[model samples]
Target: MSKFIPLSVPNLKGNELKYVTKAVETEWVSTGGPYVNDFEKNVAEYVKAKGAVSCQNGTSGLHIALLLCGVTRDDEVIVPTLTFIAAVNPVRYIGAEPIFMDCDDSLTMDADKLDEFCREECILIDGKLISHKTNKHIKVVLVVHVFGNMADMERIMQIAKQYNLIVVEDATEAIGTYYTKGKYNGKFAGTIGTIGVFSFNGNKIITTGGGGMIVSEDKELLKKAKHLTTQAKSDELYYTHDEIGYNYRMTNLQAALGLAQLEQLEGFIKTKEENYNLYRNKIQEIKGLTILDFRADIRSNHWFYALHCDENYPLSRDEIIRYLALKGIQSRPIWGLINDQEPYIGSQVYKIEKAKYFWERVVNIPCSTNLTKKDALYVIECLKNAV
Candidate 1:
């Protein structure tokens, strides 16, 4: 087949064109406009957060979240090592060090291990969780809803409460995912945390080319994030500034697109869920491969269809990825364990064994909502043949 099956791509099936054209016609193309505010409001309403702040991208949103969480230099933040590096980069952006933690089979931070790390490696000082290294307070716990699978939030939140750590969620891939039963009932993924962020990148379940949004229950923090992104300008008409700021604000054009995309967010979730089920049924029939399960109690948007290579798999992850590439199918291995990366080599990490194991076996398959059933079937066939 000449067609290249991409791992993920934006679905422009909604009112994206109409909204974008209107933005261009109105000349509302800059970082400030009605669309930007409307998009922020739409997301906030959807996630049930008090307020939302749109940023240039998820990384920027995360950076804003870290700043809001008070992640100062050399302070330690516990993060999962098995996720996309984008999720953990914000910890470093705040000049804080990340303490890499392992992930469970659900592909989220292993709360069990995190509790162990906190109880054993961390010391309590003056009602704050402090890392032994650098003697700085370990103020935040950054947890990711990996591959659209909800993390063990109950346990994670419990650990955070017990240790008095602020929870920051990287829900970039799990925007529509939510836990059905918990203290956070009817709660969306990002809203459950102290602060959360979502990515609107081209590769995500939804896209505005590139954008992100920060949400928080604290109204003050949300205002602060918005202020920081818009150069901390004190006046609307006058570009007067109070604090040093960043040009991380989301553009009007992108916000227009995001608003359009948000209208189809539920439809996209349906398509992605269907695609995941199709892949799961087909892959399960083949030996030595299993699709990672979403938590049974929650509904997952299934942003990715991750195939975990069983112990007796015929091909290594690298070999399978190469095979998929040769067939014009784009497959990706999991991100490198963050702690193992050269930039983070000396950062504190504990009980990283499982995360490292996943790094070698997890492969993200094509899971775009734009992928048609026939295209999905072709991928299923290719996997069976390759195996």
Candidate 2:
């Protein structure tokens, strides 16, 4: 019975109008234009990547990244079962199989389990890690930075190196997040991995209406991604094709919006951090409820705020979400485990321990970047009263 609080939404109160108007006035609204190039360059610089290629959306970016990783019809990619379906669907898009792994307390893929699965469950043959279960070559590790929390990239990278796995970071929720106390202390989330992808969906920390970017330290891979996203034309003038490609480039208008969004991303993250702390402070006093934290070692974007409803709490995760919804406040349970989904029912899931625990008890509260302190307190109050 108050102002509706959304779970997450874009903050578009910056140069969005100016840049988008320029694109419209200049009539560079299609897939090609200066804004597109500018957006790519700016994002590359922001993330400290060698280069970035703009794509239609994060899913398409993942598809192109997997294609460039040489993932074939039967190859396997290690992925977290605790992520949105979009993260794993791209594996299927490439006709590859996904070896689902569980999440740790941070809700990111468990690096220790990942290492165990590679060392004890798989075999190394001719410098390739072959899954003994499926007998498929595990060529890549697609790690999603769940809810803007950075995974244990340090340990995961070590494991990846040991097993010859290409690391692809799905940093759709963690654009500005970076390490503060590790080997990659100064690196951004998307830059540390072999290839990284970002999303600008409506519900993400930032939005280009709907767009994504692919970044990589390898310039040649970035170049190939750019080429492949644009129909894989060897000769642009004659439209000559060298290989199969996708029409996945971002439009100038979308890029215009993205460039503007990138400019305000730091500010957005600031708001998110403050609001998240506010939620944490308020929710801590409520019995049997704890606000899930981002990894303490990294500066997170704080994209979404999750609360764990333990047995001490009287409400179920679904009950809390439904109560909040009835009161005009939006909250949601964590995504259903991807491993349990119909498409991935037959896929391999290893040591799914913490994922099942968090999946049932974690409820994400409203955490939009534009959410005010008062809004956050209101949501917290609603939660406290719901109990």
Candidate 3:
């Protein structure tokens, strides 16, 4: 009980040290090495992607994906306001603006609102969907799978196709999540979009310290992503530069750790799913509080457990977080709506009602892969007795 229980942390009990040690011994710890290529291949094969490219981090991957989608300075992307700020920052990285959208009960982008915006607020001219208000081309729909929960891809895809918009899936928190039924049955979260990005941050299901991968079904686009991430070396021997590029390639050391983490990903997901169910059953018995559930149609990674506190709850969301902190348990409130943040003020926003509702009530509890059952029980106990 004295030990501090964290919200999420890496479980590096596998071959991480072994692979990383090997990389160091071989002096292939920088951007170029065998481990980098192996890690990319393993991830692409796991996600059923045509090809994968390694990048410095998820934000960089998203920036590259936006470029590949042809989103320019004259364009705007539709994004969810409820997600982490990293998901929306890439829109501005390319000089494009973001049109924030609301979230549904599942805490993902509301596909219905997206369709409404495109239909009633935009004009399609020669296959280009242009916003009537800003006169900017709406070229991309960037959807984030928040907390490993899959977004409503089926309806979103239909809307994207109708409006000639590119779909980019930010699967940073959903490395192993996939659909089990409907159109995308048997398909992974990142594979369903034109371009998908995955993160290997320390707190993700798996960790490479800090790294990311870009996946796509388009072979040419995948090749271009690799080129753009690697400084666009048309001639590597001569260091010839053709266009603007980023030094966003992942290091061999990070990839080595990533390869090891990827090997144990399925086992980590199993533990996460089991812990999620445990929290769900126990939280239901607590008055005025309950654990949020993932979609019934998909197999989710359950990366973080959301504890929803209602008006009837004994304590407010922030109150519960403070109480848990005093109890030596780490709990955090869900991110503030990105549209309301300082950088995004005055940016276009669709119906943003539901996002604020969830933001004021949701608390992320301890659901790390390394979290013990005793720790989870202790967390729930603290929540139940909070006054």
Predicted candidate 3 versus true structure: per-residue lDDT over 179-273, tens digit per residue: 99999999998999899999999999999999999999999999999999999999999999999989999999999999999999999999999
RMSD to the true structure for each prediction, in A, is 1.3, 0.9, 0.8
Candidate 1 residue 62 Cα shift, in angstroms, is: 0.8
Compute the lDDT of residue 122 as modeled in candidate 2. 97
Among these predictions, the greatest lDDT belongs to 3
For candidate 3, report its TM-score.
0.99
Model 3 alpha-carbon drift over 4 Å, by segment: none
Q: Quick one: best TM-score, which candidate?
A: 3
Candidate 1 lDDT at 298 equals: 90
Ten-residue region with minimum lDDT total, candidate 3: 378-387
The TM-score, computed over Cα atoms with residue i paired to residue i, of candidate 2 is 0.98
- On the 0 to 100 scale, the lDDT of residue 329 in model 2 is 87
> Candidate 2: lDDT over CA atoms?
0.92
TM-score of each: 0.97, 0.98, 0.99
